[model samples]
Target: MTRLHTLFLIGMLALLISTPTFALTGRVINQTLNRPEPDIEVSYILHETGDVTVVRDTTDSKGQFILDVPSDPGAEPPPMLFARYNGIDYPGNPAPAGDTVDIPVFETTESDTAISLSSHHILLDAQAGTATYIFIVHNHGDHTYLTGGDHGHGLEIPLPDGVTDFIRAPQGVHLHGTLLVDPRPIIPGNSQTFFTFSIPPSNRIAQRITYPTAGMDLLVQPTDTPVSTTVLRDLGDVTLGTNVFRRFGAEQLAPGTQIDIALSSPETASNLQTPIWIAATSMVVVAILVIYMRTLKTVPNRRTILLEQIADLDERYESGELSEDDYKNRRNALKAEVIDLSDSN
Candidate 1:
């Protein structure tokens, strides 16, 4: 090669080294119509520790768009992508930069026939005093299910014998022995909602799956009292970080399938509803809490530790190291610990 050509190639290499770029690329597709959705608005959310950044764009003629995301060394895994259609937000699977993701959206239907629980993870924990049930649900449907009724009762969750506090829900209103989130339309894909209600402290808790759930998993956190379920297939112990949990699994659960979960004996414990964390499995938050819980038991500065952990948890959530579901669950758990610690003092 000529010396002049070598010098030109070196300059191009220098330019590439001096300038760095991270591109988030993807497309929007309509699942119902089986066509690329053009002119739809899309947003790429960057979750960084203690911070969040949103980048917005419109899909082109071919239903594609690209956004330049700044590289963050400390950002959490799976930054989120969203496409809004028909007044609903459809989320693409979270992915890091330099990955292509498809945002799947469906046409809206007032009927609920296609709506079923793709997966349900029930977490029965003795937090504060009440027995709380957290349901993480997904809608495996080709169309968005619009909830319609006189009261918009598209989806209804019945309260067991005794329950209190609406806790948290994606959408709906509660009525008499039933928690109804009216117009809380079920969208296609994972994590449709995370909701909880507290029942009076008791040894046996009856949890009814109100939807025709395809598969379900029950996880009970470690407690002084033993926990077990006769209905679900015993999956044995599953360890998350240092915390060990007794897990059970179920499948083809028809609507109104009731499973009795036996828990600690009845007592009046403080009712603390933690609408914080929501996922069935989150290793990062689990690892973070495992360390935090250790400090809680071992250190004398329990309050100080909790306070610091709470702040740190917020940073992780904001920074994108934690999902909203896991963030909420762990945040509430930590705050509840703080409250209990204060009550003792």
Candidate 2:
């Protein structure tokens, strides 16, 4: 072969060998409505509509889920992905954080990534009497610097006093007691969202109360790195009226998570309503007493006689210093008159 032909053939072979390979890539994440929940399920799904397509997935266990999609070279540009996991529909698997692609794979590493949340601490409001709080440590995908394994997102909350009664938490679910302000985990590069929970009584309002007087400390794990930020909130005042308290913050949660709270005061017990039978009996007793008092036509005569008797006994006891026995006998006679008056009614 000529030297030029040999060189040309070698270059072509190198080009064919270096071409990038494409594969199916995706992940399933499971999650629940509650935090710190355990045993969550992550389901994956996909759907197509006409020429367009969408894909999505979710979990009952602490909101964990995954999405795996295979790319087809036969499809036109911008393939579609869809999913309907546990009744939630995603026209297309929303890209995580900063990237976007309808197809599961185009060109990327780590095809599947799992995401979930962990509950760290809860806060309470002493003055406003509302329990306001935040769930810390929600995990997302790996960033360039903070690899998905590194630093994730965290939430902070300032709880007001007197709102929730008992809270139930399951694994992977963090159940907040009464909440003043419930904030969603601040996804990096996303707009902030909040969940507003008020104490039962609408009139009882809690406003800006000073944040943690001692302040809060953020300690990152794997290393003892401490994050410092002073937490504060406006305290609210109570008005005269009915107050509502929460029973369960998150209805659905993972299993096996512990639920509890440290309180400023024990929750007030609910009062039993007055029964109809008891109310009617009391009303009849009151009516009888009222009628007896009104019908006492000889009240004046009775009052005069009792007064005279009492006066006579007092004079006798003081004058001769009547014997103790005689004085006691006469006093008893006078006391009977008063007792009679009460009994007549």
Candidate 3:
């Protein structure tokens, strides 16, 4: 053979050896419209360190892409791939090398169906003059419910006449007087809120919540879901079945109908009247004392002192005494003590 021909064969072999063997192949589809989505951006994210690497090509006309991602030996957990659609990221299953991944996307539209209440739990704390209500709101429609503008007013929940101190609302929801309004849209699926308010002590506390639509499933205590630790005591007319306290309505509620729940807290029970700030400070002090006592019993040393300082730093950061950058730097320095102690041992 000629020398030029031999050289060409050697270069071809080098090119073949350098090319990566594994690849990630995937297709993006609009599940709501039942069609392939073309020219959409897809991302591959490393699981452990949250490092993101983008694919070069968008989906083709057939909504398919093949990405030649070289396998990384340093990546602790295998990376994952997901597609972004309509300002939301839909994640796919853990994609190893040479796997076909398909991502489904949905379109958001305005929904007309009434929101359903899947669960309602009332915890009456007579001792603290507070009654905490938890409502599990579910949207069983194809579209999301937008609260403002032409979408109409959001869900209305009536509070007790003397109710005060609305404790919490869902993240995007706005609280005005007794009404809990969603400032943003309530997306499809299930969303919940734990709202506590102060009420006068009474033998029978009448709690009424008005909904925009009718169908709802009321439960005194969650059956399968482990939500809160507060338990309802002094059951009046409500019947208990097994471990669950459920009240299933036979008919869809009329639009204006008010669902009333009666709760009775024992006379011996005291209301939770202490301010939150006072309670939080007391808990922090108790935790610090307990940790200090334990450290003293365990034998004081540099390692123990470093751990205590780390805990104190975390508490100060949470209480707004330390800035984020300072807290992170100090905490990282303290964690280095772990390595020193390990070496000494």
Clashing pairs in 3: 127-270, 127-271, 128-270, 128-271, 128-272, 129-271
Error of model 2, residue 159, in angstroms: 2.6
* CA lDDT of every candidate: 0.61, 0.31, 0.52
219-336, model 2: which lDDT tens digit per residue?
1111211112223121222211122112212222233332333332323223212364334322322232222223332111232333444554555577876677766665565455
Model 2, position 247, has a per-residue lDDT of: 20
The C-alpha stretches of model 2 lying farther than 4 A from their native spots are: 1-45, 48-154, 165-186, 191-198, 209-345
Candidate 1 displacement at residue 122 in angstroms: 3.7
lDDT string, candidate 3, 1-345, tens digits: 999999999999998888354577889988667888888777764422223344544788988977776566344333446666665445555366767788766676555364776545554443344455655556666555554532245655666655544654433445577665553344455544455665554434444545543334334333322222212323223332112343333234444554444444333324354577335323333343334235324222233344455666666789998778777766665566446544433
How many residue pairs clash in all the candidates, one count each? 15, 65, 6
Worst 10-residue lDDT window, candidate 3 = 224-233
Q: Give the C-alpha miss distance for residue 64 in model 3, angstroms.
A: 4.2
Error of model 1, residue 282, in angstroms: 13
lDDT score, residue 298, model 3? 28
How high is each candidate's TM-score?
0.61, 0.20, 0.48
| Candidate no. 1 TM-score | 0.61
Candidate 3 Cα misplacement greater than 4 A, ranges: 1-25, 39-83, 89-102, 112-114, 123-129, 148-156, 200-257, 261-345
